[model samples]
Target: MAGERVSLDDALSNVDVLDDLPLSDQQPMVEAQSCSVVYTANFDTNFEDRNAYVTGIAKYMEEAATHAELNKLLEEGEQHAVMLYTWRCCSRAIPQPKSNEQPNRVEIYEKTVKVLSEEVKKLTKFMKFQHKAIEVFCNQVKRLCHQEKRKDFVSEAYLLTLGKFINMFAVLDELKNMKSSVKNDYSTYRRAAQFLKVLSDTQSLQESQNLSMFLATQNKVRDSLKEKLQTIGAHEELLCEVVNISVHMFENKMYLTPKEKQMLVKVMGFGLFLIDSDGCNINKLDQKKKIRIDKIDKIFKNLEVVPLFGDMQIAPFNYIKRSKNFDAKLWPLCSASTISPQASLMCHLPRIREEHIKYISDLARYSNEVITTYKETARTDAENRDISDLAQRGLMLLSDWTSVVTEVYSWKLLHPTDHHANKTCPIDAEEYERATRYNYSPDEKFGLIEVIAMIKGLQVLMARMEIVFLDSIRKNIYQELQDFVQLTLRDPLRKAVKNKKELLRSILVSVRETSADWIKGYEPSEDPALKGKKDPDQGGFEIKVRRRNVGSEELELSLYVPPGPSSTQLYMVRTMLESLISDKSGGKKTLRKEMDGQHLVLIDEFHKTSFIWSYLLNFSGRHAPCPCNFPNWHGHVRRTTCLYPNRHGHVRRTTCDVPRACTLTGTGMCDVPRTCTLTGTGMCDVPRTCTLTGMGTCDVPRTCTLTGTGMCDVPVPVP
Candidate 1:
């Protein structure tokens, strides 16, 4: 029995684990065991009865051996049996069909990906349902291990497999929780999207028909509101004007009056009310709010709703004004008043207008400081430098300015200039050609043109400002005169002067003369009387120099000249203009050399000159000779004496000059000539001897053939 136990131990120890073997090799071992069972069952065979006896014995012995081995495994080391069974049942890879084909890399890759994809697709579901299966398996293993028949079972492989199953169950529970959270998020998001879609489909007014209907409804409502406001008397009449005034006053640190407040309440319509400083309701209106203008005025006039505190403190601008002793800031706490729970707190909050005003002023001050620094820097850099140096400095300034502007533009507060939009100059062909003659980078050229346009716009703005200032002054003076006539002196004649038709012309004339004189010093380079071909009502300057050929169409040149402070810059600009006017390309090039790199600057400084030319042009007639080419405007001398037409209707003749400079015989008068239908006789009245002398100097000879009698001073002729 000891030897047999030793032999059994050795055989069991010699038994090899086939866990890692391929199914092809493993299947043969199982077949061998079955074949041994068949051989043992068939040990006794009686030919005919052998088959039946073998089958019955083989089935009984196979069942008995399996049961007995299982019992032994459980009593000894059930963990090893469980591990081996679990590996075969659950963890083993699926077996491929038996074939002699070698593994293809492509097919292997495809198969591996397919398997992995399937596993990933079901991983979430697997993790969810796997915990229960793992738990059951662990419990069964524990039961087997703790069983009275197999309590001592211990296998390292089985222990390791059990631990892995336990760990997998724990990880699967955590995974299940994660999947549940993800599902919950997805569901919530879907529900929210569904709600939003439903709401938008039902309530959105962006559809064309809906938008039109809404707009029509809004118009009707606005009309009704305006009619209601109009029926409200003085409040209605002053509402629009007062709203603007109040807002302006508000910006300037002034509080709104009752009228202004009432107007705002009516116009703004909702989400507003008047309140006292103490968190108390001075007045409240329904959500469909309206206030009687008279009531507002009365409330302020009567000085209602005073608090307990006195006037030792300065009241906030947003707070209601109170009587002297009740104007204190702490009055809200001391006073007993009706409180509101639902009112907007902002409506009752005191606004320190002075504080806001100070803040705005500070911003303005800072902006002005920056502007001053820029101006100073630009001016200083430009001073004492040649054109090239100035241009380099200006380039630096432009770089800085561009950076600053880029930042400002990025803020999206204002639209930037579209350099490509309508990128062409409105000038004559020659002028356009001249402007484009200088080669420059596209960016530089565009910038130069845009800056020139901006400079023009700036000048226009300044001119407008000047005109407004002048108009204001005139109006003020006129008002003063009317006041003097109506109020102070009470002179009826002067009052008549205001309304009388006859005096109207004189008054206008006086006003015009006064205005002219007032702005004389501030006048630009042009005379206002002849400012441009454009009408006075148009209110801008334009200059054009045209040359008219006698039989051809007129050629034109538009000019834009900007003004500058520097004399040298101004001189260079003047030189360029003179050259342009004289049609001398050489002169232009000379000036260009002198003002190198300062083309933009020089051109901008000619605004005043252009304005002057435009002004002078306005006084001239359409048929007038072009100023650019005065006498030889048509490329030739049109006249020898007078540039314009004279009284004689000839270009050369004046009123005093006669057509004939000399009569017959070429003297001032026809003395020696004899031609007379009036005399009724034709004769050579001169002496024959004097005729002998052929000299026609005085029609007399110094020494002649006929008479040499000291040579008669008068001419002698013979016929």
Candidate 2:
């Protein structure tokens, strides 16, 4: 007979007779009974174990075993179930009544049924928690599944959780109703509760055994969730109820892959379209339901956290392409696909476009902050005449551009109007020309387009700053180091020179001696001996040696010379004087005190020669001695003390004359030749008709024979 439904109150009132109904009326089918058996035996719902349990029960029911064998299987299975349940209840600290003999089979079955009933009821507790677990798993797969580092682990965990869910649904589908034995929804709770009312601690057994089985499954699921989180490098707090995870759960749970998220958002929009399909001003379904734009905006604003499908290397130029020329040339560095189909679909949505614009606005604001900060820092650095900090900050900005461009590419793709590329606001040609100077239109200076250009410009500008400013600083430091080294070496060099002063003076003396040796017998090109003839046209030449002269009309000659200080002695003295003067200390005065007479003579000669020849020429004229008599024309020189006008216009004493002076007087007294004597002014003694016109003796001895006519004796006899 089929069991009839009875109220829980009536069953409680008649608890003693609850098992009096026909046994066949409440027997669960083979699968349900086997599920309870396996659950009680091992608490394992793995496929192989569940299958073996069901298959064995089916074989027994199909009579594959004898009647005795079937009876033995049932007895053994009931005893095992009772033992396990009793142990579980004891472990939980639940009290149990003492039993002397083995409990009746009916009593065991009733207790087992109560345990399964509690297990089923407690499973309800995990419904909300299981749903959250599934949601969390889905988000991890969607968000982290595509990451290069996370793909393998996250995918494995995702499929694992998905398989668990599928198996759970399959088990729920195969469960049989307790009374019908044909699968139908059944209340294992009421049947177990009425049958177990006879026992004092049945509620305790129910709580311990039922809740344990339920918690076992959920704990496994939580472990799987923990594994998945770990695989994605999530923090430990993210696996728990930390603030970041809580906020993340609320805000980011809907972050699917770009394609799935795009489809989901579109489906939601379509659903709204259907709800408002009639375009009717329908009466309020509930008076409290007012459309809250703020709430809607808040929900939509949270969507900004979602990663967009803007993985393009360069922004789309579609809008500007039709109105003007545009091109995109940048290549993506990241491995994400350049084009996503769902992203293309989302690009057409008005709401998506608006969201993207808002995102672009955010990017623009952030980039402006970066630009303004960099400009200020650079300006301050320039003012302080320090570029070390400037170069560092510029490099930081350059490195930051990679992420900035990534964000800009995403937003610029979703933007509907390429206003930056095709702007025509200022119609004036001059304005357009001016705007192009900065490589952008004036209107584009603060928005997305300018922001994009600004990032690129900043990269270039920062690189140049690093090169120019840093290099200049390096050069300046190098130059300063060189100068410091030179200055540091100066004192040592001066000390070394001072230490070698004696050796240097010896070298100077040696050099002077060698120079004198070379000059001793050396003939100069301007020596008077090399001057062949002073007058080229005449057969005779005038030689003005001191005061010497020779034969008149043949070769007039007069000579005079004076011997002065030797040149070698003069050179050595001059060299010593130079060394003394060059010595910076008080060596000059000491050297002057040590001078002897020869040093004084050389110094005096040098001072006398310092005047020009014209100034001393009058000395030769005024102080020259008269000519020596002929036949005594040997060279003689007089030490002429000449009076010459000094620079002060007073007569000053001078010992110098012409470099080679003559002894002839200014009168013609020395012009005539000497007649007979070799000495000066000696005249011939004979009258006319003698070869020696004025000699005292005749050239022909006694030829005149006392004839005073000064003719030969033969000419006198002939007359």
Candidate 3:
């Protein structure tokens, strides 16, 4: 009654809709609403309580009221109320505690990778277990690795490391090829690794970064990486390239230390010593893994990069020398081995023999070319240049051949000089040195000064034996014999002569005379013994001088004469030899210059009595010394000199004083030297006896022994 009245604006909008229904029609609507709630207890209604908690019918209006806030507070309020009502219905009005859980992908991934690594380790070690275990483990990890990011990391780590395990085991043969199902192995690991890299690139560990989506796969993918690795058949050839490419890397100040460089010497040099080429040479072995392991062992001699194992002591040379192990195992693959006196020299050398042979042949050809170029270049002078300045180009040719010489020297070291002589064995230092001079032993020095001292002694020997231990130097002075020397020393070289033995006699470098490079300036106070000092003189040369006015330079080149097993002093002995040679050839004489000066220390085609001083010189680049074609090495030298004693404790030459020189067939005179005391046996016809004093002797006693001790305390043989 007080406010039935409406404002004019509302009255116009409602049109006082009550106007039509108000008096008569509205009477039942108003009367029913007023009486409805009077029986609420009987109606069993919770609507009022629910409405008290919920928002109004006009949600937008309520939202508008709280528009200043960012969150939709009204909607949230309604949701909370609805949740409370539902909780009350289902949970009997008991309040539930809020969960404190969050997604933990980090722990999930780490655990998966760890488990996978452990499993793969077991596989590598050949541990037997249900293959199902690995499968189940992977499945469990991937299932929980629900997040795309986690699956990628786990799969990648599993595949790559596991693949490495497979390769290693394949080498060791712990796991044979099997019939196990790999529908998941290939698809899960290999593909996961491939894809995970992409994912890691796109998204990093930062929490702000978005994770890539991951899709579960039921299909398997085939990986062919190993196939590609296997397709590389010419392994030795490729490795040679690797060596050639990496050689300068170490040589060009790139090595951090000296030991690294030293290690390379063994690695590269040893490889060349054994065979001609690098890979599938292992197929020539009992097992391919052994060669790889051997190579790995060589690499570790440098102390860089973690090694899988330690120093392996093997009787490496036995197999190469005579074991026949490799040939038996790899005969089908054409694998064979050669040996030398030095142990461990040819062990595991060339990976592929055939390939290596071809490589060496190529190197040898290049070396020959260099030798030819040197000949062409050295003869042409600038003023009288022959064929487009050949002389100007000769020095370059010489350097090239020198390299070839070094390569050939390496090969000779692998294959030592063969025995053509039947000389008596030489006495060791303990036997000979103690009796003559102070006792000494060989030892390597560590300091650079000491090392340089070693070089000095070697240089002296090189100077004395210019034609023997020749340096790889090209000069127009020795042009006549240069090409011959190179041809002898190239990779595929001729036979190694007992040059060092003869060299020792010529330079006077006996076991007793050497000490810390002292030989360079050494002058023997007492002359070296010859034939037990019976002669009191080994050999001597008369020196001569030659003065030739070459282009008005007044050049003087001296020459010296050769004295077999003589001359106590080696200092400048080479010069003495040359001085004697020039005078013998009837050259000009100079008074002031000593006749002992030598321009060249050695020469071939020497007089017959001088065969002890001659050595054929040939050179090359690869470590394969082929046989020499000696123009003067007639069959007579072999037949006649078979009884002559060489420096290596064996008889080398049978011809004495032009015995075979006069005629190709030797007069079959048995003039072999008697090394033992006479015992009235048919073994020797020469009259000799054994005694310690001054090479003197007594009649052969019934009880006397020839020992290294030079005593006759016991009988060596019954008389």
Which prediction has the highest TM-score against the true structure? 3
Clashes of 1: 13
Q: Per-residue lDDT for 1-719 in model 3, tens only?
A: 88797788997868767566636431111011111222111111212222231221222223222221212322332332232222111111111223325244334334333323332333322222212222332343333234432212121112222222222222121112221221222223323333334225433322112111100211110012222323333423333323332333334422222222333333332222222223344334325332432442233222121111111011222222232223333321112243322222122223222333443454345345544655322222221212112321222222222222222223332333221221222233222212112211112111211222222322232223232112221222122222222221111111111222232232222212211112234433342232112222445421111211113333221122112111111111222222223322222332113212221223212211121111111111110111111112112232222232223435333222221222111222222222233333222222233432323323333232222332122223223
In angstroms, the error of model 3 at 455 is: 5.7
lDDT of 2 by residue, 1-719 (tens): 37988889888879967768666542222111011221111211212222222212232122222222323433433332232222211111211224536467456546545444534443444333344544544464444334342312111112222333322321221121111211111133333344565334866566545444433343344334334444443222122112112123224432211322322322221112112212211112112332222232233332322212212112212111221111211112211334332222222234433533553454345445555665311222132224432433333332233223233333333432333544653333332122222223333233333333433444333433333443333333222222222222223223323454443333333322332212224323342222321324544333221211112332332111111122322222333333332212223233323334454454445323321111111122211111111011111212334332333446544342112222233221121222333212332211223344443322343244333343322211210
- Work out the TM-score per prediction: 0.14, 0.15, 0.16
What is the lDDT for 247 in model 3?
A: 39
Cα RMSD of all models vs. native, in order, equals: 58.2, 65.8, 50.3
Q: Among these predicted structures, which one has the highest lDDT?
A: 2
**Worst ten-residue run, lDDT, model 1?**
306-315
Give me the overall lDDT of model 3. 0.25
The parts of candidate 1 lying over 4 Å away from their true place are: 1-374, 377-517, 521-719
lDDT of 1 by residue, 638-712 (tens): 222212222333433222111221224242322122432222233222123323444331222334322344432
Q: Which regions in candidate 2 have their CA more than 4 angstroms from the true location?
A: 1-388, 395-409, 412-449, 467-719
